[model samples]
Target: MADVARLAGVSAQTVSRVSNGYAGVNEETRRAVLDAMKELDYRPNSAARALKRGEFRTIGVITFTLATTGNVRTLEAIATAAAREGYAVTLLPVALPTQDEVRGAFSRLEELAVDAVIVIMEVHLLDAVTLTLPPHVQVVVVDSDAGNHYTVVDTDQAGGTRAAVRHLLDLGHETVWHLGGPEDSFAAQRRADAWRAALAEAGRTAPPLVRGDWSAESGYRAGLQLAEAPGCGAVFVANDQMALGLLRALHERGLRVPEDVSVIGFDDIPEASSFLPPLTTVHQDFAEVGRLCVAAVLRKVRQEEPERGTTLVPTRLVLRASTAGPGRRDAE
Candidate 1:
């Protein structure tokens, strides 16, 4: 520390301020300190600093998987938000959704050098035993029904599903068929329940649900079944990737989108607008969800009482060419 300070002609405190990214260091002096450190190949001792401060300025993220678009997007947002807040994120990936795997991840929390944790996993996987974490480690959860026990941040999945279903119904479709995601996913379950509720509210019975594994392939399979079924005019797919597969299956079955079977999907991913006919879908604010997760965890870290109950980032319906009135069949 003194060698770089001597080289830069700055005090040890000035070097510390520059290294820690603290304000009040002039640009020229900061640049000189950085140049000296680079020349000397000096690295700040993060562990020593953390020990002195009593906080690591690091966050641990535990998740079962990042296979889905929602998970990947949410994680990306979390990382970005953490970086803006000057905190590092350490991901602890669980091999499975089992309670044992989650427990194993939690057990190693102290060793991970994180002051707080944000868990992004299905709520059901967090049993009573697995929910327990090491003492003094604050937590915030995403996409789980852990609001009653932990600070929760998530998209308004049910509200998004309702908007999609209602949009289809308002287009004169008698009943909207559903292509749901996996049975175990809390987000998927919420969407499915909302779809049903929206249908019942309109005094219409929902068609049998066709479940998918949140994959384009699973959606293709489910699409094949829907294509073969009679009275399958409007469909509400759980996600955009699945909707991509469903669109393919319908096209192959001599069915034209909107003209034959109007479709609406969730998660207005970037590619949604580039689909064959473009996708009219639900847009979730994943970045907001991530920002809230970091904010909530930092609140706990600061000994502040985070607001209990779920913080739902609202979603909106995006209109595109994929959906239309049933009477538009001959227009295609």
Candidate 2:
């Protein structure tokens, strides 16, 4: 610090202000301090600073698994947003959604230097576990229904699902069939519930709800069964992977898409546009969701009134070749 101050021709206090990112220093002085830092190879001790300021400038993230596209994409977005905010991220992957697993994750976090936590489970097992978190550590959750209790940032699952079903019904399908993800997934349940509500509102009877493990293979298996169902004209899948599988099953069954069936999917994964007959689906603003989560959590970290209830990032319906009016060849 003395060497940097001497080299930059500034007092040690000025150097401290620049090093700590305190805002009073002018741009020229800041640049000179930075040049001195670079030339002298002087690095500030972050741990010492953290101890003094009571802030680690780190955010911890917890998630069950990264096998799913939504989790990985959202995690990436959160990391990017955190970096932009000059904060580092620490990730702790819980092996399961069980309360024990969640509690274990919290125990592990206790050993880390995180100032706040962001849990990306999209599961409802955190309500009890959240109460056990350190009081100083503000938490923001993703993809769960704990909004009434904790700060939440998630996609508008119900809104997106309604749009998907409405699109299919307006295209002349008598009723839309739902190929839902795992029953325990909050997102999947929201989508399934919305699908039923949308159908009911349209005065259309919903067909049996098919279950998938969020896998294309599961979707393919479900598709085979649906292919045998009477009056199966349009389907809304939980995610894009399953939608891909459903398309293949339909193809194997010699059913032409749009000509025989219409398919809609969620997430709008990158490959969605290139699927055999591109997938019409719900476009989740994952980056936006991630950014908002960081913002909300950091607000608490900064000791602002923490956001309660849910902050829903809106989704859009992406039009593609996979959907059309019943028996029509072109997409709507």
Candidate 3:
């Protein structure tokens, strides 16, 4: 910073204001400071900056895989929102979720002196480590109910699944079979719960649950089971990706969608509607989830109380051609 100031022919305070992105610095001065910084290859020490201002403009986000389509969309939203608010994000990958790994990651973020942290991991075990975060640093968990003191932003998984079931029922399906995501995921659990509740509400028995690991293969296996099961005319898959696999499996089994089996999936991913028999699925705005999570962290850093202890972003039901009335059940 001193080098930048010297090169720019400005006082240290002026350099500080420019580096901290204070609005009072004139555009010309800000540009000059930036050019000088580029020439000198000067990098502001975020830790030192935090020490001076009692907050870091940097946030740490811990999550499982950014490889997944849903996860990537969520991350993009987080990055966009953080940048708009003049905060830089540092992503910490929790490759394999274990208690020790999660705790260690948070401890490292704390040591890095991030002002606030957001955990986007979806597994249940994260709850234990998240609950122990230092009180001074604010934390928010995405897509899980960890019972932590800090904020939690989750998708209305149950509600979305319920909507899918209701859609099928309204189409006159006798019952909706469920192909669920991995058993360990909070999302999978919530969707399963909702599907069950919706069935019970309609005075119908919930079909046996078939599990998938949010993958095409898992969905294929579950779809195979459904294809052979008698009276299986309608199926609700937990995610779009799995639905794709399920579709393929059903196709191989000579089961025509809607004509033979009506399949509805969750998470109306970009490709869902383009499948061989366009998918009917639930859509979740994960990007909104990410943006809100970052905003929540900012509120904590600004010493403002966030309105909700836990925020659940709503999901919408997308109707495509994949699902229709449960046509002509095979006579007993």
Candidate 4:
């Protein structure tokens, strides 16, 4: 500190302010201080600072996998939001979706230098385990049914599913088939339930669901089965990746999308627009969901009354070239 202050031609207090990212220092002075610190190879002791402030200024994120688009995007959003608030994020990945894995992760929370934790896995696994954490550490959950016990933030899965189903029905499709996600996924189950309810409400019989593991490959396999089903003119796939695979399978079977079969998907991923004929899909506000998760956890950390119940980020349908009125070939 003394060496940096001397090199930067600033007082020790000014160096301290710059090192701690405290305001009041002009840009030029700050830059000079930074340059001096760089030259001296001086690193701020975050441990000492955390101890002095009685806060770690860090957050822990526990997630099962980053393979899914929603989890990846949500985690990105959380990191961005946390960075803006001058907080660092530490990710703890659980290799599998088991109670033992989840419990193992939570047990380590006591030793982590984080003030709070944001769990991004399904809540059922947590419920199955006798989990314990540091009493002072606050918690926020994403995509879970634990809103009654913790602050929860997630997309409106059911509402989005309903909108997709209704859109297909209004387009003159007599009934819409479904390609659902894995049964264990809460979001997938909510979507499946909404799809069934929407069909029943419209006086249309709901077809048996074909499940996928939220992968393009799984969707391809399911799509092959749907392509052979009689009167399967419209389909609602759970997510866009599976929709991509379904599109391929349909093409292989010479099924023309929106001509013989119309398809709609969820999670309007970046590649949806570039798919052959473009994909009509549901759009989720993943950034908002991530923002809310960070906000909820920070509020809890501050000893503020945590916002109870779930905060649902609404979803909307994006119409594109993938869906249309049933064609002449459909009547065959």
Top TM-score: which candidate number?
2
TM-scores, all models, native as reference: 0.88, 0.90, 0.86, 0.88
Judged by lDDT against the true structure, how good is candidate 3? 0.83
Off by over 4 Å in 3: 1-48, 125-132, 329-332
Report each candidate's C-alpha RMSD, comma-separated, in the order given.
3.5, 3.4, 3.4, 3.2
1-332 in candidate 3: lDDT tens per residue?
A: 78888899999999988887788988888999999999998889877767977777889988887755567777778888999998988888977777677778888887777778888767674454533545556888787766455588888888888889999899888888889888878788888888999999999998789898898888898888888888888888888888999998989998899888999988788888789899988999887898899889898888896864678899999888887776654221
Candidate 1 lDDT by residue in tens digits, 86-202? 999999988876667766787787787788999897655344445554545688889987657667898999889999999988888888999999988888888999999999999
Residue lDDT tens for model 4, 3-73: 99999999999999999889999999999999999999999988998989989989999998888998999
Among all windows of 10 consecutive residues in model 4, the one with the lowest summed lDDT is 125-134
**Evaluation by TM-score, superior candidate among 1 and 4:** 1
Worst 10 residues of 2 by lDDT: 125-134
lDDT of 2: 0.89
Spell out the clash pairs found in candidate 3. Answer: none
The reply for model 4, stretches above 4 Å from the true place, is 1-43, 123-136, 328-332
lDDT of each candidate versus the true structure: 0.89, 0.89, 0.83, 0.89
- Clash pairs, candidate 4, are none
As for candidate 2, its clashing pairs are: none
